[model samples]
Target chain A: MDKPLNCTIKNPVNLTLGDIKVDMLCGCKVVDITFPNIMSPEVGEIRFKNFYVATLTVKAKYRTENTPRHTGDQPKWKTCLKRVKLMPDPHSEAGSHDYISLTSRQFRCELSNITGLRLILHQPSPVWREFKLEELRLFRSAGGPKTSPLPTWLLEEPKAKVQKKTVQRVASSTPKGGEGGVPDLDGLSANLQQLWALAEEVSTSQTSQSLGRFEVDGCYDINLLAYT
Target chain B: MAAERRKAIPSTSDDNKPLDSDKQFLERTNVNAVVRDVLGKIIANRPEDPVTFLADYFEALVEEQSSLVQRALRVITMTHHSRPVFEVNVRDSYNLLSKHKVNKKLKGVNGSVYTELLQALCRNLPSSVTIKLVQKLECFEHEAVPYDVFRSSIFACCVLREYAFIAEQLFASLDIQKIGKADKALCDAVMDQLKTALGSSRNDVRRIIESSYNLAPEGLHQALERALSREQTQGVCTSEHFITEACDSFLAKVKKLK
Candidate 1:
């Protein structure tokens, strides 16, 4: 919605992409989407929800940091996907609100470090007045967290800091099956650990109370207060 | 009663002579005052089933007579009044839904519990809001329903009444971080659709209220349609402001359509 769209029918075309009057729109339009600082995702894939487009072409501008020539330079747009058929019928309500996912596997170029995306939408039907890509979102690869970068172990190259001969590996002894052995209790809190240690003693001393007898101390004859 | 208790305890020891220890036991127990309080309630309320009432009363008394710290905490948390208090809002509904037993993998809760929660929450809201909410629930009495069904129904209730503020609060409370931002984005997208639809034919709104509120006689739809057309003719901007105004006019028409 950063730039105004020249809609054919509506005087002031709706800027929001959430909902668009399908009948009002005519011919082809190229929409450039620049991500805000908060959600400027490194593109690994794209998902389109509730779309009714005949064909969609995708282009990406990757924010390259390694290259000195690309720094502070104009966006070098590269077409990653070309003329993918989203829906068989753009005019009909069939597949009008279908979800579509375009992964890096479908794209020709690597979708790393994508800061911006361009969608070329082509629809040539006058029958519908309300059509829109109800939602558009970018996501990182499934191998790592979507919002955060890859784990350090995965990203960083291996370094052989320790000498192999000096390294000592301690082998844990097998636990005894009998009552005395302290079993390995993983993920238990310190309080829970102490409780587990005391459980045997506690169970031995504990006794179930008499269900029928309701008494004050040992006295059966006593006045009881009314319940509120 | 203390004198009587002293006599009763002495009879268990020696027949004629009363022991000093038996007298002390009677004095220590404070039996008379407790009996008096119970008698006072029995006389006042005059419950039909005295034994059952006494059982419940004693059970509650035992619970209240816990440790001093526990009693203080109970006082802070529990309502002092005898009657249960009801809250009329989506947050309360959300809290109830969350606390209800659910199978995590299946994403479903007991359907009856869910319906009861919805009914309790919508008790004080407008009839139109409640009816729409009930219809949107789409949950059977005995079958289990997915978690999102409850969330969407609550949102529908808020939207029908144009309580956008409450809807936002509801969204914030029920939002699952694991699902990422898509759920919230979809919610916003749908709300935006409603706002946008208000400008055009208002067919969406008409479709929504096609099944009118109870007591909203026939021609209620026509009246609402006329109101919407009149509002449009007056040139109210078809944006966020118009949505609010349109909802108000729509509600007003519903009220007077009879």
Candidate 2:
């Protein structure tokens, strides 16, 4: 991987934007957004994941005086706002938004790796006007259904001899999901059970690999050899 | 014992021959593995014609092994090792993928292959090659170059120090409001470098100051004012006199333009 894959949640998540404050000025402006932490009951801690979609239900109206002049040609006035953009970073490309009229217009956006959402309002007319945001919501889809749990190989004893046995157990097991389930001590000989217990103990005790020997002189020799 | 030994010797010999041939065939045909190995070699040797050899070898698999293009690109970038050869490989693979419509499979920000390609170029290739790559990227109508990649190129210019003018040009081209928090930090870092360059060397301070002004005009003015005030407090006539003079002239010009 070029960089570490972002930590993600396996379940769908949502955030309500009722209390967040938005600051705006006359002419073209932007709305400020605040994102809340998504807590998982299963993980028993706060889980942070990028949102997949943002839905904004807003009520806004353009001042009639700010409307564009109607020339003999087509009326240049925009009944709806133009260039409505939603983005996480101030610099990134604005996510998708649909242009609609003044009463309860819903704007949906698909964005990834965003901490907060910012709204950019582009109005052609140079008139000062106020825009109201009635509601906003953020949603994230589950990372697909949880697959079968991680293989037992990762939890196996790390000793070379026991590792070989663990691989054999994993490979010989059928896809039926019960072959590696419970070790039947009732069927196994006492000696085999003792051996298995010993292997597990050895594997768990060593948690990591031993640091290998190092020789500064050997490294110096190799460096010198490269020049030669 | 003698019969067993006789059987083992022939069996071992037969196994070794087939294994070697099978390994050779796989190495020659497996497009992903071959591309990865070639990328590694390019980093080490920087061959002249990186794309041609791979292109010819995978002429048949070009259509079949289309999925491997992302992997190949990932290998090039993830290794954090780059060369002219790797740059060509990345461009050629990107083209091939686009031709086959394999890029449709990519998702989200990761799908910005143009940005990834440019990032690799900025990190690995020479300044001239990176400049050319950026030019090529700008010409594409469908692909909008990511600001992170642009920021990285600017950072690369600062590190190279020879291409300060390119950094200036980049700062001027970008929209100030579109600069992200990370991008803002990079802008500040580059400006700091420019300030150091101005104070120490007899280089053209006008261009550097102009670029900084273009990047953040108000910020630059505030910084200059702060620096001038700080200098006054110190009560020392240092070499910073010329920088202050240059800033004054640039600020005056900006006022005239307004």
Candidate 3:
């Protein structure tokens, strides 16, 4: 759709520790990119320029009360993607410069309350002189329509439903037609009413069958497994 | 002999010290040896019900000199002395893979079955092993994979993990006749990749390989040399094929030690 890139990146938070813009990351096995005190509830997509790495593993850390803790800090680091091959052939220079986008669906855990991301870059061959990803960015939306349109039935008023019921009652009171080719609408409405009554009776019987008690009418000697 | 053994029972009035007659009875019946043998079987098998196990044990003892107990005892002793080495039972792996219902006309296993087979086989092994194996197979895009591909992919993973002993056993169990050939250049290339992947843990992997297969330092070197130099074929060697040959050579070295 040729949507604009980085349009939803509001207030890109810097590193929690340092202020350096460009760092020499040669010979480094692991690098971390983090955003401190992010206000977004969820991240829609993440994109980064690839470097000379055979395999790039993406791990995410988030703060969650649902996860139990024994002796650690409030939010702990957890693994998301154990291994992701960014550059298929590390020895070759084909896909080394391409930008890779990881959507929220790709992440193993929920992308909310995300504190940091760890990028583990590995080059299985020693031929690469330098390796590091660049231009890392996270967006709140993927530049597509957020939700589908509501169905037409959901937008109708309550008066329409009352009109439908009144039409069915009128059809049921009408007499049969003389022409044999025409279908009987009166008989059809009567059968539909009978079916609806049967369904309601079954549902009420199910609800009344259970009393949530072990004894029947205060008699503890009753056999629970008895059929009748 | 039974009469003589029974006569040695001591009186209840005596304390912990066994009388001479009681000692003689125990010695004649070999009570210690019999008890040790039975207990060893019970511990090794670990049945759900101990009382039922004991009843069956006594029943077996009555029917021909307790040969079953002696066999079970042998298994226990052998396992105790050796490291619990992994064996690739292809029949068992195939049985597990085939248990999931799939279309016979498809001529391959379902993708979920393939993943489950890898997980089941790689249990107790490193998680990286399964991850690497899945990536190496490159069959995630396919709806189904042939049986041969699955077998070879598993072997490739073991080789990558430096599990030469396991890889070698899997080769034999899968009845793989020829993994083609690799020249010295191919071996050197594959080894370089492995060295880079392992990084500082290369020595640690070597130590593990040595301990698991009981290989000496010089013996491992000799095996690698033989595997690289002995091949004369000019066939194109993939990384997996080269590693398999190296593991086979390691197995050959182990067999020589025995």
Which of 1 and 3 is the better model by lDDT?
A: 3
Ranking of models by TM-score: 3, 1, 2
Instruction: Give RMSD to native, each candidate.
Output: 32.5, 33.3, 34.1
Sliding window of 10 residues with minimal summed lDDT for model 3 chain B: B249-258
What docking tier does model 2 reach? incorrect
Per-model fnat list: 0.00, 0.00, 0.00
Query: How do the residues B84-190 of candidate 3 rate in per-residue lDDT, one tens digit apiece?
Result: 22122333344445545555554335566666555544454445445544543444423555555554444443333335333333223222234433344434433
lDDT of 3: 0.47
Candidate 2 whole-model C-alpha lDDT, 0 to 1: 0.34
Q: Which of the two candidates, 1 or 2, achieves a greater lDDT against the reference?
A: 1
Across residues B62-154, which tens digit of lDDT does each residue of candidate 1 receive?
675453323322222222111122112233344434444445443334566666655654555555545544654535554654434444443
Model 2 bad stretches (over 4 Å): A1-228, B1-9, B12-69, B75-82, B100-258
Q: Residues A120-162, candidate 2: write the lDDT tens digits.
A: 4433332313332332322343222122244333332233434
C-alpha TM-score for every candidate: 0.24, 0.21, 0.24
Q: Calculate DockQ per candidate and list them.
A: 0.01, 0.00, 0.00
